[model samples]
Target chain A: MVTVHSTSPHFKANARRALGDEQLQRALTNVPGGFIAKRQHAKDKLPEFDALRDEARDLKNHTLAHLDVYLEEYEARVIASGGHVHWCETPDEACRTVIDICKAHDARTVTKGKSMVTEEIHLNAAMQAAGIQPVETDLGEYIIQLRGETPSHIIAPAVHLNKDQIEADFRATHTHLPADRQLEEGAQLVNEARQILRQKYIDADVGITGANFLVAETGTSIIVTNEGNGDLTQSLPKAHIVMATIEKIVPTLEDASTILRLLGRNGTGQEFTSYTTFSTGPRRADDPDGPDEYHVVILDNGRTGMIGSDFQDMLRCIRCGACLNHCPVYQAVGGHAYGWVYPGPMGSVLTPSLIGVDQAGHLPNASTFCGRCEEVCPMRIPLPKMMRHWREREFERHLSPVTVRYGIGAWAFMAKRPKLYRLATGIAARLLKLWAGKTGRLEALAGAGGWTRHRDLPAPQGPTFMAQWKRRRP
Target chain B: MSAREAIFARLRHQLAAGSSEQDRRETASARIAGHAANLIPARAQIDHGAQVKLFIDQAEAVQATVKTLASHDDVPDEVTAYLRKHNLPQAIRHGTDAQLSGLDWHGRAPSLTVSHGPADPHDEASLSHAVAGVAETGTLILTSGPDNPTTLNFLPENHIVVVRAADITGTYEDVWQTIRATYGERQMPRTVNMITGPSRTGDIEQRIELGAHGPRRLHIIIIEN
Candidate 1:
């Protein structure tokens, strides 16, 4: 029902297209400059911020270690609270389960909160195929949905769009409204969206939302949002469905709080989101207004494979998009270049695991390894190290291109004999110095066209670092 | 095998040092029942008076307006004044909480028309009584019941919440402890909303705009006396 043109295999071509996209480049300029200062300010205000991150990491580690037991406990608690849990091994099964639930409710229209898990499974397209309208309530998501595009950024789904592009999209889609309605500013666009989505929320038969955390203690699903769309989507509908991965479950409220401290500060630089709603189950007997039925669809979709593997640490990701915010590679090319639901350093490590290494080989190779993504990650996920692991896998599987393999092979062949390696590098450095003349940089180079296409490669000043180190020390 | 059983089996199989099923269950049960508090921020460990001040400061820091009154009797007049000052409609909506119902809105603001129950699209303002306020981040914890219907929290242009000074605590952990005592062990209200500020979104090129789908303005009334 859903189409995924994974350009991850064509990462080079995708990156080139992204570089040429002026609008995307304009949108991407906001990331490195915008998020860094805000995160720093939030971190600086709290002295115990780093300590909380450590606690968060430890809690996730502990939870993952006993995932099966914790999940069993969580399922029991959910059932006790009058909610049903549907375990889905794959995306197709998850989609089928959701459709069955919708059919059971006789739902014509389904409203949704911003959920990356749903995006992972392409829920919107599937719902549409089933003759159900899936209305994205998040302003960002709604905009992207209107454009029929996947999210470029995790938190900000429409981060790649500019105000003008949005204005045009609104004009093109919202034909019922006055075509000349002013939408010059972000405020105007927001107001227009609010007016449009308000009626949809009330008319919706079922509401689907993603949980930031699923509490095993009380069987509560928590969603943190700056806009209250998630609340409106769930509260007004007849049935509420939570689409979450199995890894989202946590032990207690205290643990949830510990992670909350890191999530808000790192993700949006808020002490707390405007609204953090914890929903346990269907509306109670005393409740005046709420959904009558509650259901949770827990999808595995290759996450179980991540457990006990070297990539298991990835399960700790809370989907804050902090790595995307801080990743230089992500900032340069934007998220769409990575060509999947996730993008950036975390995506580089995760895409291979979810889709396959052969498909997402370019993701790991795309990183500069400056280590900013890992430094900024609230869960302390060793992202660069994981990317290296992926690269190793790609090479071991012979997924790397013949040219790259042969280049590495030739280098390795010489490197094993220290004298031969030193001689090769020494000669190359001297030849490059001679070719440089006064400019001291190569504007063009044969066989290294990819490197020279954008910017000049700096000429080597002297022998390689190994030669210099040996001469100085020996 | 069912998806659930198969997934669980795969997980246990992959675990490096898989414990007995009983051991795993006990560990999970102990953690849940214990509800142990981890490292709380030193900032939240403060005296009551300081906690109140910190609450106000934190709330204001997030663009939420704060006003203090001596008692609940002053609430209706304050709400009327806020609506008039902002040049908004004098119409408001609220839930049937005793704390809110006890306020003499008919006597105080006769011109202001107030409705009860869940919110609709046309609502200009709505009010509720918070179960507790967290000082650590200036968050108001509102439990869903007949007292305060969850819909009033959203679907309005302006949202006003009245919080008793005594109910405001130093951290979210304190609020959780209070919830346990109020709702009984392991039972929570249908929904517990922790609201720090009015609705906002930064989805448009990462620039924040207030009142995306909820109240544009959030005014908190702290009863200090």
Candidate 2:
């Protein structure tokens, strides 16, 4: 069982530790392993990629606007197709419904596809506490599961570890294998885990997966994956459960196609994932294979409040992790430093909404506002704007520190008076130059010791911009 | 209140009924019923021969093997040859798909054994007939039913799919249209599996290793009938 003890409030502390950890720094260096280049290649292949992104964003907006109608229609179709739809307003209800389903079948073992929603709800812990052995079939999720850790990255859960770390994990867990077997390469580790999980797939009594999109037109739940773990997890089990949030619902299959064109290309830079499965319900009576029972659980959490609010655009997110891949902050600190299930720009905006700003105010403040996340987003979500919104909410709610409030208040005070602002900036620039000496840098400072502790801050070299402009004109 | 009712009520309250509630409901239902295609890529708009070429190119780009045969009778021989070349067993598990059942396996590979129905725990290879092939991404659409068992597509180490040349379409929109015509717009099979290549994972240090859980090798046999 994995527990989400979020260290989000201690983001600065986590980041400080992460920066100095040699192993983590080495792992983080491999963060840009062909992701940016591959995404560019995929984009180059499809000229309509941007146009498709626009359509996708608009489609999501339309669907979310009428989410109630689409959800209702989707529920009816699922029931008509011999499946059950369970609406859960909270994570506890979602976990209870899953456990109840497993208990009804007396499931001893349950296999799972990679699902962030399940991560958000901490379903594995609840299931394990109920005495059900939940096995993560995805390669990345499986590694993290063995280590009893949550995912560091949304797409690549184990991206924070190297092959050596994974090899050690495999050796420590798989005792049945021959001693001193050469488990050095990535291929060898993948093969070992594949052989170990194949038996678990057949042994499981129930399987739970997350839906990439739910089609209200045909009551279909779609999942896109490069590995076929999700298919095997759901197909072999006696009962299959799809755990999804309400925003996952789309109006029709065509709406799904609009987004599908962008999902793989943006995430992994593949034109399409190896497997894009659309499962409507349980197996037919005449079918030779498939789960006999199918259930769909729709969790709301706080998404219902997101609609018609300032944060509504954030709902267009497809969980592709493109923003995370391109984020400079994520590349430096890695995901765990963000201190939550989600990290990077998307996490910056979403974590606060899901877990309250007071608990996660540091996340929105962690960004450099480089806008790379927004530029690369398949849905074109205004991530920086949303982060700014979260900052505003934090400030309004008095969640920001006193120092930050005082600094802002002082800056706002002079900004209204241009003459005073110019005078203060001119004086500060001269003082900074005097303090910098020949090095032209500030190795230490009185008020902001935290900034200069690790690296020297560049001193202001000349007069302020306003002073220079006035002097040149005169 | 029940969770469902509460959720709906909250959403309604948040939406605040900007327009007539009846109008919003109608608009939602209308969009689902219409289900129009939006922004079909120009790459998938080529002619038939070019479409097949594009499909083959796309499939190969994703690390899948393709074989074009003049008839379905060549399927068994090709399957046997693939197995022999790879040092795999000459056993294939398959479902009741008519296109697959009509093939003469005994004539081409007399020593090969065939298992009918879903995949067993030890099946080395499996065969299924693709309902349609999308040329845009070289995606094989397999609708799950008695004819094509869902398990056969994922459990085996090797997967071979047979698709009629006429069934290969230009885009996903065309395939969706065919599905709508056959199963109605509001209905679908229990599972519609769109397979582009064999299973692979980039989890271990972001390195791609084929056959993570499903078939390590994906072989496509397109009948040019």
Q: Give the winner by DockQ.
A: 2
Q: Which sections of candidate 2 miss by over 4 Å?
A: A1-4, A470-474
Task: Put down candidate 2 lDDT per residue, B152-191, tens digits, no spaces.
Answer: 9999899999998889999888888998899986989999
For model 1, which pairs clash? none
TM of each candidate vs. truth:
0.98, 0.98
The per-residue C-alpha lDDT of model 1 at residue A459 equals 93
**Candidate 2 chain B lDDT trough over 10 residues, lowest sum:** B15-24
Candidate 1 lDDT by residue in tens digits, A326-433: 887888889999999999999999989998898888999999999998999999999999999999999999999999999999989997999998888889889988
* DockQ per candidate, 2 decimals: 0.86, 0.89
For each prediction in turn, the share of the native Cα contacts (below 8 Å between chains A and B) that it retains comes to 0.90, 0.90
Considering chain A alone, what is the TM-score of candidate 1? 0.97
Candidate 2's fnat?
Answer: 0.90
